[model samples]
Target: MLDTLSLYVAAPEILLLVMSCAIALIDLGVQTRLRNLTYGLTVATLVGVTWLCVEFALEGQTIYAFGGMVVSDPLGNWLKAFAAVAVLVTLVYGRPYAADRDMLRGGELFTLSLFSLLGMFVMISGSNFLVIYLGLELLTLSSYALVALRRDNANATEAAMKYFVLGAMASGFLLYGLSMLYGATGSLDLDQVFQAIASGRIRHEVLVFGLVFIVAGLAFKLGAVPFHMWVPDVYQGAPTAVTLLIGSAPELAAFAIAIRLLVEGMMPLAIDWQQMLIVLAVGSLLVGNLAAIAQTNLKRMLAYSTIAQMGFVILGLATGFVNGSTANAQYAYSASMFYVVTYVLTTLATFGVILLLAREGFESEEISDLSGLNQRSPLYAGIMAVCMFSLAGVPPLVGFYAKLTVLQALVASGQAFHIGLAVVAVMLSLIGAFYYLRVVKVMYFDAPLTATTVSAPADVRAVLTLNGALVLILGILPGGLMALCADAVLRTLAG
Candidate 1:
C-alpha cells in the first residue's frame, strides 16, 4: 500500500530520527564538561537533515507518504530546512551559556532539543488531523520539560506548570475542533476534508463552530493575544539558553502548521477563519506593542515583541483569502512566510547577544544590563543594534520589507476594511518601534555596568556575525527569498 519512493520522500525525517536516538545513546558515555562528542554528532546530524531538506525542496515535487498522512512539499521542506538551521544556531549560541549555569551536566538539553526538532518535522508534514495533534503533543511535552530543565529553579518549575496546564487546554480545543470537522465531513485526512468542505455539503453552522476552537488553538501556539499569557512568564523564567531555543526555531514549525491547517486544508472556509485572524491580529498588535513599552526585563519585552510580530504574520494570512477568493492567496501567504523567516533570523541574533552577556550567577534579564554595550564590545553591540533595527522595521533591514509585503498584500485586496487594517497595522508598528529603538538607545548611549569585555566561543562569534549580516543583506536583496516563498506557495496550491 506504500509507494517505493515514500522512503526517499521521508529520508530527512528518517535520518533525523535515527541520528537523534543514536546521539542520546552516545551521550550517556560522554563525560567531557562540554560534551564535545555529543555536540559534534548532534550538529552533524542537523546539518545532514538541513542539507536533505534543502535538496528535496529544490526538487520541487510534492510526495504523499504513509497513505497520505504525511506530505513532502517544497514549502514543508524549506521550512524544515530553516528549522534545522535555527536549532543549529541556537545550540551554537546556547551551549556556552548552558555550561556556565551547569545545565550541561547532562545530555538532556541536546537530546530534548533534537527530539523537539523531530516533533516540528512531523507537525510540518502531517497531512492528517490525529497525526498533527500527536506531533503537537510531542513538541509541547518536550518544551515543558525543557522549560523545567532547571529543576532547582523555582521560577522554571512554576513556568513549566503554567505552560503545561494552559497548553493542555489549548490542545483539547484543537482536538475538539478536529473532531467536529471529522464528524461533519466524515474524514480525518486533510485532503479528503478539503474535498468535503469544498463540496459545500457540510452544514455551515457546524463548520463555523468547529473553526472557532481550531483558530483559538492555533493562536495560542503562535503566542497571539488572549492566549499569549504564558509567553512572557516562560521566556523570563526559563534559562536564557532555553528561552532562545524556544523563541527562535519552533516558530517556523508553528507557521507551517498554520499553513497546513488553515490554508491548505480549510481554504474553503477562509471567509469564516480570516475574520477570526483579523480580530486576533488587531488584538495582538494593540496589546503586544503597548504592554512591551512598560517592560524593563529584556526577555519579557522581546516576548511581547514576538506577539506583535506575529500580528503582521496573521494579517498576511488574513488578507490571502479575501471575499472567498484564492486569487491572492499565494502572494499574501508568501509575505507571511518571509515575515516569519526573517523574524526568526533577527530573534536568533538578539537572543544570542543576551545569552552571551549572561555570566555566572548574573542573569542579563534587565534592560539596564545592556547599558553602554558599545563601550564593552562593539562587535556584539553592533550585532544587537542590527537586530533591533530589523525588528523595528527600519529600511534596508529584512523586517521592513517583511512588513511592507504584507501591507502590499492587504492593499492589493482593494477592500476598504483591509486598507483600513493596513493603516492600523502601520500605526501599531510605529508604536512597536519605540521599544525596539529604546533597546538600541540604551546599548549605545548608557554607561557600561561592567568594564569587562564580552566574549563568545569562536563558533558562536562566526555564526552570530553571519546572522546579523544576513538581516541587513537580505533586506537589500529580498527578491530571492520572496521569489522562493512565492514559488513554494504556488507549488503547494498546485499540488
Candidate 2:
C-alpha cells in the first residue's frame, strides 16, 4: 500500500485533479452568458496550482510517490508550473476568440483545458510506462474534442479525425514498444527497465527493435518527420483559439515524456536511440524549413516551424552521448530543456497575436492578413515581430540563445559528425529565417488591407506584453533561466 506521506510528492497533481473535476461540475450551474465565471475559476485554479508547482521546483528535491510510479523533482515541477502558466495564458488569449466565434457555448473550453492540463501534469510526473500512456491518452483525447469544438466547421471536424487517427496509430506504436520492453525486462518501471537493459541479460537486438518503434512514436508525438503529417492540417483547421491551446503548453509535456522515456529509461541504449534521433532531427529540419518556405498561410507555416524547432530539441538529445561517454549529458539535457521552455514562451506570444487579430468573421490566419499590422497596432506588430525574430534565432532574443546553447552542446561533444551536424543545423536555420522575416516585413512595410484597429482585452494585452518581454529578457540575461534549467536537469540526473 502507498504511504500517506508519499502522496505529498504529487500534491499538485492531486489538487489539480480535484479542481478540474470540481470546475467541470460547477460549470453546469454557470449561465450561458456568465461563462466568464467558469473561465475565472479555471484561471484561479491554474494560478493556485502553478504556485504549488513553483514551490516544488524551487525546492528542487526529487521524491517518488505511489511506489515509484510518479516523481516530484525540479524538472517535472518546473515543467508543470510552466505548463500551468501556459494553459492559463492560453485560456486568457483564447477566451475572446472563442466567444467571438460562439464556441464558448458552454464551459467545455475551460473544463477541457483543465483536463488537458491535468494530463500534462501527469505526463510530467509519471515514471511508469502505464502512467505515461494514461497521461498521453487523457491529453490527446481532450485535444481531439477541443479541436472539434466547433462541430459546425467541416475543417475542424476533418482535422480532428486526422489527429485522432494519427494519434491512435502513434499510441499503438508506443504501446507495442513498451510491451516489448516489458517482455524483455520483465518490468514496467522505467528505472527497472534501465537496470534490466544495463545488466546485459536482455537481447540487444530486441531492445534495438523496440527502440525503433519507441522513437517513431515519440517522433509522431513531437511532430517530427516523417510522422508529422497531422500538424499542418490540425494547426490550419482548428479554430485559432483551439490552435493556441494545442500549440503551446502540451509541448512541455512532450518534452517531459521524451525525458522520461529516453534519458531516464533508455539511457543504456543511448547510442542506438541517438542515431535514430539524428535522422529524425535532420529529416525534420529539411522538411519543416523547406515546406514552411512555400506556405502562404501563417498557421501552416508556424506548424512547420514547430517541426523544425522540435528537430533542434531532438538535436540536443542526440548530443547527450558521444563515443559512449555520458560526460555531456547534463549540458545536453539542460540545453534541450531551455530550448523547449523558451520555445513554448515564444509560441504563446505568437499565437496570442494570432488570436488577438481573430474576429467574429475573420480568421486572420494568412500571412497577408498581417500586412501593415504596424500601422494598425504597433504594439501587436512589435510583439509579432519579436516572436518572429526569436523564432529566426536573431540576437538579443530567447530563441537565438536557445539555438546557441543547443549548438554549443553539439560542438562541445568534440565529434566531427556532431560539428558537421551543427553546421547543417545553422544552415537550415538560416533558410528558416526567410519565412519568419517575411512575416515581419508584411507587418512593418506592406500596406494595410483593413483600416480596422487591432484590439484585445486588457488581460490578454497584459499577459502578451509580459510574454513577449520575457522572450527578450531571458535572452539578454539568460544566466538565471539557464542556471535554473541546469539545476533542474542535474537534480533529475542525480536521481
Alpha-carbon RMSD of each model: 0.9, 0.9
lDDT of 1 by residue, 1-495 (tens): 557787888798889889989998999999998989999999999999999999999999999988899999999999999999999999999898888778888888999999999899999999999888888888899999999998888999998999899999999999999999999999989999999999998899999999899999999999999899989999999998888888888899889989999988898999889999999999999999999999999999999999999999999999887666788888899999999999999999999999889963599999999999999999999999999999988999999999999999999998999999999999999999999999999999998888898877899999999999999999999999999999999999899
Error of 1 at 471 (Å): 0.6
Q: How many backbone clashes does candidate 2 have?
A: 0
Worst 10 residues of 2 by lDDT: 28-37
lDDT of each: 0.92, 0.93
Candidate 2 residue-wise lDDT, 217-331, digit = tens? 8998899999999999999999988888888889899989999999999999999999999999999999999999999999999999999999999999999987888899899
